[model samples]
Target: MSKINLKKILTYGLVVFFIVGAVGNLIGPEKILEDYARWGYPNGFHLVTGSFELLAAILIFKSSTRFIGSLLASCIMFSAILTLSYHAEYSHAFIPLIVFMLLLVSIYLHKQKKLL
Candidate 1:
């Protein structure tokens, strides 16, 4: 496939992933709430995170805002990694770390003008 196609695939994949995650956060499942409580966050904080996630995912679809979206997503993932690690949830932390790397790649490609 062409480089443009690959970039589109990656961008869309990230968008889907973030959207799913945001929806889950907004839905606030039992386990998710438990995790937040364990992490010392208020119950309502999930909604806040979910809102940001949704906004970032939407921004990522537009060329002009893609960098900011990636940056926000990266920040969110980094925060998740740190919080999970603080709770000794190593396995859980790994997932966010992976997402963080993907966000970094998104940021790089966006800056390199390869993602438009």
Candidate 2:
């Protein structure tokens, strides 16, 4: 596959992931709140994060705003990973950290057209 095709695929996949996460948070507020509470965040934070994720998803779907959206989404994931690392056991934090790092790499590849 070509570099451009790989970038497009990754971008589409990331957008779908973000959109699904946003929709999940919106549809399952209680589950998200439960997870957040376990990580020590307040109930209101779930709504705020959900909104941010939704907006990021929308922005990511647009080519013009993709880089900024990817950066913001990375920030959000990084924040969540840190929060979980701070409050939860190490094992619980590992997955998020790995996921966030993968996201960072994905964004980097997209930016450099190296995904091919």
Where is model 1 more than 4 Å wrong at Cα?
Answer: 1-4, 114-116
Give a tens-digit lDDT track for model 2, residues 1-116. 64567667767777777787778777766667788788777767777787888887888788778778888888878887778767756676776576577668666765775346
lDDT of 2 at 69: 86
- Positional deviation of residue 21's Cα in model 2 after best superposition, in angstroms: 1.1
Best model per lDDT: 1
What TM-score against the true fold does each predicted structure earn?
A: 0.91, 0.77
Q: Provide the RMSD of all predictions against the true structure, rounded to 1 decimal.
A: 2.3, 3.5
Which ten contiguous residues of candidate 1 have the minimum total lDDT?
1-10
Q: Could you tell me which residue pairs clash in candidate 1?
A: none
